[model samples]
Target: MPISSTRSSASRIPLLDILKGLACALIVGHHLVFYGPMSDVAYPLAPDLMDWLFAYGRMAVQVFLVLGGYLAASTLAPQGVARFDSPLQQVLRRFVRLSTPYLAALMFNLLAAELARYGMDDGSVPAEPSLPQLLAHVFLLQDLLGFEALSAGVWYVAIDFQLFVLAVAVLSLARFLSVRWKAPWLAPVLVLLGACASLFYFNLMPELDTWGVYFAGAYGMGMLAFWAGHSTRPYRWLVALATLGLATLALDFRGRIAVALVTALALGVLQASGGARHWSPMPALQRLGQMSYSVFLVHFPVCLLVNALFNQFWPTQPWANAAGMVIALALSLRAGQWLYQHVETRLVSMPMALRMQGGLLVATGLVLLGLKAL
Candidate 1:
């Protein structure tokens, strides 16, 4: 859900990285318990902990969505004005950057799922992908086109792309309106209105989840937090951000939205207090945060692999399955580190991204076709 190419090494915000890291860990833990024979076997040992992780751990995504918006704002529209001349170029670049690492990770996931299926017959093992399903995923359209995701959290990748396009379009139009009327308020006002609309209307409809508007509330809040954080009147902007979120909750409560609101607000406060820059984070947290997107993308396949191993060898050993959860987490972090270094850190172009995605599709299709033949 995040690969912030916004700030450079020197300008990186520790707070953002720390939060993203913590959120990434929760997301991984949540899935370890969720997509598991491991967690199923170990559940009786710590039902309350397992229950809580399953129930609320996924909400950590709200943190990523919010942080993604915040970073997007910093990169795309720091001044609440459109910086890019061509919105298409901005979006295309973002797509390329996102998809490069994404397709690489998808390739790993596809192989991992196949390996897991070979090992165990759990329902969580994604079935062999059809051609159309693979094509939709290549374009980050699996969720939009109603294909079963090849892996968990794939929908978020599509939604992230969609939300970025929406933000660019909205802010580009705001720039046009701002110049035409000479009103600075047009940009933030439009963004705020979109956020309000989502929080009040679109977000309530489960059907709209595939689109950006459904999650625009949190994303917009993050955008606004950027503007507000750098504003002359930071507290005033903070108040407005808080007020909008509170109003939404007062009217119709949603725990996910509540987490988003809190995350945005926490970021705002940190930025306002200069803690975003000055706070020294532990090395581990910062490293994890820096590679949070990598972890987010790759953790699922690792979890599935570990779960399959447990299913095959230690299916009835509760303690062993519990240890498998830890093993999965360690392996996930290692896999993410490798992905970050090998793929995410590369200077990939549009062509390269397309080639990787094409390779992913062809390779994954071959695996599926081979299985069918057998």
Candidate 2:
């Protein structure tokens, strides 16, 4: 059999973007149903379909976490130590890339909420925000520290940020151990062992204030997939074993099966598609994939705004509610894609001096985790 090849390293592992986009869309639908008319302060009307979509919509976030782990692991490994840039620089880059858009979304949500109240109150002028905790919101620590999220969709960003830091450490350790052991495979093996330890720790002990273990495993798996894809003969056996494990996880054995299954499947996707691109003649999905972050961030506020506006006007039209939701989702995705291309893409490439900033972030995260334990 002829193995597939690609010009771009990213093209070799194509499923991730698709999965991420799917997750974001599911989240949008989920939030629409979740915070629709059922919410206490919801507008007087929302679509009846909200109840139906709620359950299915809830699965998107977890899927995203699993996907995050797989990608983090695959993307962070050094091409060569001699050509290796500092890991800290990479970490800082990730932080800024994720944070800038998140902050923008937060601001938009804040402004939208204020304007919403004004219009709802018959134009008497909106009340000021009592949720001043928006101050801590940008750091992605609010959710873990027991504060409500500053924006509706920010909890996942918090999760991603936490996972990113853990991933850096995990990859760094893998690199260090590889050098000490004098074997290339040693690093990957240690990473696998570490993943198992994390899975066990998170499942049984569960004492850490943060859920970094699971995230670490997932992101590390992604990195592994990336490596396997580049190899002449990838680890086909591991993929098979992971697939079986995933099937068992789907059976619900109450043994962190879901995590194992999700982790496995995520890696499997990367492994199988490692050499191939799921190309399409039509580019709609590629566009969606590109705008995924924006879609994920902006969807919540759109839903919230739609809910408020719909209730004020319709008061009880379920069909109209659904129609409005569809429209808002479409418009939100388009806007998100536009912003991502114009604003986020450029910001993502901004130079950060890697040595100090990335190292400090990794140390800070570890210190924070240790403090949580103590």
Candidate 3:
């Protein structure tokens, strides 16, 4: 659901961006098919294809998870040492940066939901949000608090935040332990052990899905990829990564984990082979990748609106609905482009980000009040 960029263009990896673009496209398609009436109407045309997408499209999220980890490691601790002065400050900054655009997207989603309610009586349109629900989303605690997500894939945002915080904490702990033990290798070793624990234990528990530890293995694989890419013994690191992932699957096979492991390993291989550094940028793909976060944030609202239109005016016509799906996708990209340019790319200050969050809460109140009156 996310990514970061701190490196200069000259230092950036083209392949990662290209992969992100592809993964973002898959996630968008997954939601388009999984959520609403468009896919339902078009199902008979391609039952197998629709089913396949419904079942596996979400695996793209693992790609994002690995990518997020890779980028986070490159920025947070490229050399496996904590670079920031304060973990709290770094975490808070990440929260602010994430929520600034997120809150705006939520506003669009809330409005779209209301509009969708009038157009279709389907389950895809979210129910009117309560105060606690709105607040949960504002604080990125919706999943932990057991609130129904107001939009598709928002859980990933909360999970992304949790993963980042977890990463920061682990790195800080590793730094402390390294100093205390007088062993520089402890940082990477501790991280590796933690990732193994997550894969072997925490990741297997469905009840812990809302927490960072549940997804730490995939993210850790990404972090390890960074270290491996830079290490002289890249093959050893790659073998260790593959062994851990494969062993986890041997115990309990999860296709998502497989995707994550493959993504991480591929990234490690690319980084090790210098492909990551020398790859030529595909302009279209890289652009899509750069704005993929915005695409992820805004696509739901665009999808809702398109689905509503088709449901209200053109119910159950296969070709029309399929084409509407295409239109929705195109509109989603356009909306994402607008959002990336207008709201997401802007450098929001702490004070302004706070105000935006406040605005989100206030807007949600107004919408709920309107719903009640109606």
Query: What are the lDDT figures for the candidates, one per model?
Result: 0.86, 0.58, 0.86
| Candidate 1 lDDT tens digits, 25-120 | 999989988896889999999999999999999999999899988888788766667678999999999998888888878877888898898778
> What overall lDDT, based on C-alpha atoms, would model 2 receive against the true structure?
0.58
Q: TM-score for candidate 2, please give it.
A: 0.75
TM-score for model 1? 0.94
User: Lowest-lDDT window of 10 residues in candidate 1?
Assistant: 1-10
TM-scores, in order shown? 0.94, 0.75, 0.94
At residue 298, what lDDT does model 2 achieve? Answer: 72
Query: What are the per-residue Cα lDDT tens digits for candidate 3 across 180-279?
Result: 8876666678778888999999998999998989998998889888777667677788898899899999999999999999999998888777556767
Error of 1 at 253 (Å): 1.4
